[model samples]
Target chain A: MIKHDLVIVGGGPAGMAAAVAAYDSGVKDVVIIDRDASLGGILQQCIHNGFGLHKLGEELTGPEYASVYEKKVRERNITIYNDMMVTCLTADKIVTAQGSSGILKIQAKAVILAMGCRERSRGALNICGTRPAGIYSAGTAQKLMNCEGYSVGKKVVILGSGDIGLIMARRMTLEGAKVEAVCEIMPYSGGLTRNIVQCLEDYNIPLYLSHTVAEIHGQKRLEGVTIAQVDENRRIIENTKRFIACDTLLLSVGLIPENELTKEAGIPIDNITNGAIVDENRQTLVPGIFACGNVLQVHDLVDYVSDEAELAGNGAAQYILNGGCKGDSVCTEAGNGVRYVLPQRVNTGTGKDVSLFLRVTKPYGKVRFTVKSSENVLAKAVRIKAAPGEMEKITIKADLLNNITEPITVELEEV
Target chain B: MIKNITCIICPKGCSLTAEINEGIVCVNGNTCERGKQYATDECLNPTRTVTSMVRVSNKCNCMVSVKTVKPIPKGKIFETMELIRGAEVCAPVSIGDVILEDVFGTQVIATKNIDR
Candidate 1:
C-alpha cells in the first residue's frame, strides 16, 4: 500500500490549492488525484473572464486562474496522479483508487474531498422527449466548443438561465449560432447579475422568467421544443405553450455535488447542500476525512471554493502535525430568509475566526443579516439587495465564537 | 443629457444616471465608489478588457488564452478578434508574454503558460 501524508481527491482548483496550502503548512508528502489527464477541473472548460477578482485581485479567465495554482503546485513539486479515480474511501482514510495500470491502495494520514460537482442531466429535468443527438449539457457543450473544435448546433434554445446557459447563449452567438431564447422556471435568475447583463442583455437574447419547456418536438435530433409559461405553482399553462424551432437544446438546470465517493465513505451529507456536513474547519464527521469546494456546497464563485479548500487543507495538516483541532462544538441554524448555511457546526473553543457562507430562500430588498446567539447578537451586515442568485458571507470573529454559550442563528432582518 | 447606465463594477448591477452639464458629468444612483467611476468612464470613453484565445503551433495543446494588458476601446473588439483569429504563437509561451504588440495601442498578452 502506498502511503502519503495527505491525499486530495481532485486536481481541480480546490485540490490544487489545498495541496499547495498543505505543502506550505509543513506537510510535505501530498498527492492530488484526478480523473482527467490534466489539472484545473471545470476551469479548463470555462474560458470566460471575470474570475479571481477577489482572491488574486485581478480579472482572470478560468484557465488563467487555474494555471496559477497549477504552477504553485509544480513549484512546490507536489506529486499528482492524473487520469485516476478513487473507487472507495474508507472512514479510516484508506483510499482505493484505480488508474490505467491497475488498482492502487493508499493509506493517507488525511484525505481532502475536492471532487467538485457535476451538471444535472436532462433526466433530472423530467422533460418528456426522445433521446436525441443535439441535446447537451451546458458544461458538455462548453467543453466541446472550447476544448474540442466542435459546435453542438447552429440554432440553440437554452432550457435554464443558469450561468452556463447564459454564457453559452453568448458563446453560440459569437460562434455564428442563433440562440432563440433562454427559459427559466424560477421567477429570479439562477445566474449572477453580471452574467445576465453581459451575456444576454449585451447579445439582446430574450430571457423568459417563470417559463419552462413543456415538451420536446423532434423525434431524433431536436427539430424544435415547446416552451410554456408557468404559474405560481410552477405548473405549465396549457394555452401558453409555444413552439420554437431550434436544432440544439442545452440544459443548465442545476449542478449537484459529485458525492458518490463521500457517500460510499459514509460521511454525513447535508440535504440542502448535498455535500458533507462538517464544522468550521470543513471537516466531516469522519475524523481524518475533510471536504471542501463544490463537494461541500455549490459556490457562486470559484474564489470561495479556493478559500474553503484552504481551510480544509489546514485542517488536514493540523490533524497530521498536531492532532485534530477538536473542541466543544455548537450547531448553527438558518433562522429566517436563509435557505441553508455551510459549516453546520462550529467548535466554540477552537479560538479561530469562522466565516459562515449562506444563501437566502428568496430575494429581498434592503435587508440586514443578523448573526445572533440566544442572548447576544454577534454581528450583522446590511445590503441593498439580497438575492438567491448571490451567496452571502458573514464572518464571526474569534472572540465572539469563544463566548458562544448557545446555538447560533442567522436571520435576515428587513431594514 | 442624462443616460441610464447599468454599473458593471460588480454583480450588484446598480442602475445609474449620468448627466452631462458642460462636459462635467454627475452620476447618481451609485451604491459604491467604483460605480461612480464606472459611470464617468462609460459616459466618456467606454473601454473593455478583451479576453480571447490564440492558435499555438508546435503541437502545444490547441490554443493559448490571452487578454489585453489594459482595457482597450470598446469599439476595437471586432478588430482585435479579427487579428487574434489569424494570430499564432509557438510553444513554451509564458504568461504575460506579449503575443501581439500595439493592438489598438494595447498589447494582447498571454494569461497562462503553455508548454509542449
Candidate 2:
C-alpha cells in the first residue's frame, strides 16, 4: 500500500492543477493517477487552437495549454502514474487501481477527483440510423484526424453546434473535406460566437439553427441525411425537410461528466451538472474527497476549469492539514432567473470570498443578479444581456458571509 | 463630429461612441475598463490571444501543450508558433508551469499535464 498526503485522480488539467495547489499549499506528498498512457486528457487530441484566452490571455491549442502545465508538474517533482486507472475508492480515501504493471493501492489523507469529463456520443442520443461505418462523434473524428493523422471522410455533416462541431468544421475544411453544414436542434449555438465566425462563417459552412437531422439514410456507409426545421416543441416541421448528400455524419450533441466512478464510490451526484454535489470548498458529501473541472460542471472555457481546480486543490490541502474545512456550512440557493449555483455550501469561517458561478435559464435583456441573505442585499451585478451559453460569476466577500447565519441565495431579475 | 466605436475585447461586441471635439478623445458607452482600453487600442492596433503547442520530449510521445503568457498583436500566430515549436522540455508536467518562460518576453505557461 502506498501512502500520500494527497492523491489526485485523473491527471488532466484539473488533477494537475489540484496537485500543484496542494503541494504549494504545504502538502508535499502528492500523487496523480491517470488511465491514459500519457497525461493531458482530452487536450492531446484537440489540435485546433482556441483555448487559453482567459487563463493565459492568449489563444492556445489543447496540447499547448497542457504542455505548460506538464512542465510545471515535472519541475515540482510531483509523482505521476500513467496508464493507471483507479478502479475503486473507499470512503476513507483509500484508492485501488490497476496499471500496466500490476495492482496498486493508495491511502491518501485527502483526495481530489479531476477525472475531467467524457463526450456524449451517438449512443447517448438514441439517433435512429443504420449501424454504418461513417457515423462518428465529432471528438472521435477530431482525434482520428489530429492525433492519428487519419482523415475521417471527404464530405461531412455535423449535427450539433457545440464547440467540437464548430472546430471540426474548420479542421475538416483545412484537411480538404467539404463540410456541408452544422445543424443544431436548439435555436442558439452551444459554441462561442467567435467559433461561429472563424470556423463556420470564414469557411462558408452554413449553420441551420432550430433544425435537426430527421433521418440517417444509408445502408453500409453514409449516403445522405434528411434535415428539417423543428418547432417550439422540437417536432420536425414536415414541410421544411431537405436532403443533404454526405459520406460522413459527426455528432457533437453534448458532453457528460464521466461520473461512473463517482457513482460507484456512492457519492451524491448532481442531476443538472452530472457531477458531484459539492459546497463552496469543492468538497463532495464524502469527506476528504473533492471534485473540479468538467467533472464538476461543463465549463465553456479551460480557464474556468483551471480556476475551479485550484480552489479544489487548496481546499483539499486545507483538509489534509487542518483536518478538513467543513465548518458550519451554510446552504446557497438559486433564486429566480438563475439556473443553478455551484458550491452549494459555503464555510464562512474559511474567510475567503466565495465566487458563485451560474448560468441564466434563458436569454434576458437588462438583468441584475442579486445576492441576498434574507436581511440584506450583499452584492449585485447588472448586465445588459445574459444567455444560457455564457456563465456568470459573482464574488461574495468573506466579510459579507461572516455575519450571515441564514442561507445565501443568488437570484436574477429582469430590470 | 462624433464617431461610434465598439469594444472588440469580447464577443459581446459592445459598441462605444467617441466624440472627437478639437482633436480631444471623449469616449462613452464603455461597459468596463477593458472596453475602454479596447476602444482606445481598436483604432491604433488590435491584438489577439496567442495559442500554440510546444514540443515535449519523446517521453510524452512527442505531444505538446500550451498557454499564452500574454496577448500579442492580431495575426501574429505563425510567428508565435515558431517560438513554441523550438521550445522543448522534459515531461511529467503540472498546471501553470512556465514551459517557455517569457517567450519573446511573454510568459507562456502550460495548463495541462504532460507525461515525461
Candidate 3:
C-alpha cells in the first residue's frame, strides 16, 4: 500500500485548491486522485465566463478559473493521479482506487472529500413520457456542445430555470437554434438573477414561472412537451396545460452532492443540505477526514468552493500535524426564514473567526440576518435581497464566542 | 425617459433606475461607484464579453474555450459568435493566445490551454 500525508478525491476545483492549501500549510506529502483523464473536473466543459470574481479578483471562464489552481498545484510539485476512480474510503483513512493500470490502495493520514455534485436526471422528475433520444441533462448537453463540438438540438424547450437551463437556453440560441421556453416549477427562479436577464431576457426567451413539463412527447425522438402551471404546492393545473413543439428537452432541475464514499465511510449526513455535516474547519464527524465544495453543499459560485476547500485543506493539515482536534463545539441551527447553515458545529476554542454559510428558505426583500447565541447576539448583517438560489455568509469573530455554550442560531427578519 | 436596469456587474445585481434627459443620465439605487458606471454605460451603449469554444485540431481535446479580451458592443455579440463558429485553431494553443484578432477592436483569446 502506498502511503501519503493527505489524499484528496476528485481533482476538480475543490480538490486542487485543497491540495494546494494543504501543501502550502506545511504538509508536503499530498496526492490527488481524479477519475477524469485530466484535472479541472466540470470546469473543463464549463466554457462560459462569470467565474473567479471573488476568489481570483478577475472575471474568468470556468476553465480559466480552474487553470489558475491547476497551475498552482503543478508549481508545488504535488503528485496527481488522473483517470483514477476512488472506489472505497475507510473510516481509518484507507482509500482504494482503480485506474487503467490496476487497483491501488493508499493509507492516508488524512482525507479530503471533494467529489463535487451531479445533476438530477429525468427519472427523478417522473415526468410522464416515453423514453426518447433527444432528452439530455443541461450539463450533459453543455459538455457535448462545448467539449465534444456537437450541436445538441435545433428546437429546445428547457425544464427548470436553474443556471444551467438558463445558460443552455442562451447557448442554443447563440448556436442558431430556437429555444421555445424555459419553465420553472417554483414561483421564483432557482437561478441567479443575472442569468435570467443575460441568458433568457437577452435572447427574448420567455420564462414560465410556476410551470413545469407535464408530459414529454414522442417515442423515438423528442417531438414536443406539454407544459402546465403549478399551484403553490407544485401540483399541475390541468386546464393550464399547453403543448410546445421541440426536438429537445433539457432538464436542469437541481444538483445533489455526490457522497457515496462519504456515506460508505459512515459520516453523518445533513438532511437539508444533502452533504456531510461539518465543523467550522470543514472537518466531518469522522476524525482525520474533511469535506468541502459541492460534497459538503452545492454552491452557486466556484469562488465559495475554493474558499471552503481552503478551510478543509487547513483543517486536514492541522489534523495531520497536531494529531486531532479536541474541544467542545457549539451546535449551529437554522432559525426562521433560513434553510440551512454550514459548519453545523463551531469550535469556540479554535480562536479563529468562523464564517457561517447559509441559504434562505425562499426569496425575500430587504432583510436583516442575525446570528445569535442564547446569551448574546454574535453577528448581524443586512441585505437588500435574499434568495434560496444564493448562499449567504456571516462571519463571527472568535473573541465573541468566549464562554458560549448555547447553540448558535441564524435567523432573518424582513425589513 | 426613465428606465430600470439590473446591474450585472456583480452578483449583487442592484436594480438601478436611469433617468436620461438631454443626453444626461442620472442613476439611483446603486450601492457602489461601479454600479453607477455600469448603469450609465448600459443606457448609452451596452457591452458584453463574449465567451465561446472553437474547434481544435491535433489535440486530445476537441475544442478550446475562448473569450474576447474586452467587452464588445452587445449588438455585436451575435455577429461575433458567427465569426467564432467558423474559426478553428491548431494544437499547442496556450491561454491568452489570440484566436481571432481585431474582433470589433478587441481580440478573441483562448481561455484554456490545449497541448498537442
lDDT of 3 by residue, A189-308 (tens): 999988998899888999999999999989899999999999999999999999999999999999999999999999999999999999988999999999999989999999999999
Task: Name the lDDT value of residue A206 in candidate 3.
Answer: 95
Mind sharing the TM-score for model 1? Answer: 0.95
lDDT string for model 2 (A243-329, tens) is 999999999998889887788888999887789999887999998899999999988777788899999989898888997775687
What TM-score does the predicted chain A of each candidate obtain versus native chain A? 0.99, 0.97, 0.99
Worst-scoring 10-residue span by lDDT in model 1 chain A: A143-152
Candidate 1: lDDT of A104? 82
**Total clashes in model 3, counting residue pairs 3 or more apart in sequence or in different chains:** 0
Error of 3 at A34 (Å): 0.3
Where is model 1 more than 4 Å wrong at Cα? B57-61
- Residue pairs with clashing backbones, model 3: none
lDDT of 3 at B20: 97
Give the alpha carbon lDDT tens digit for every residue of A269-325 in model 1.
999999999988888999989998988899888998999989998888999999887
TM-score of each: 0.95, 0.83, 0.99
Worst lDDT 10-window in candidate 1 chain B:
B52-61
* Model 1, position A287: C-alpha lDDT score: 92
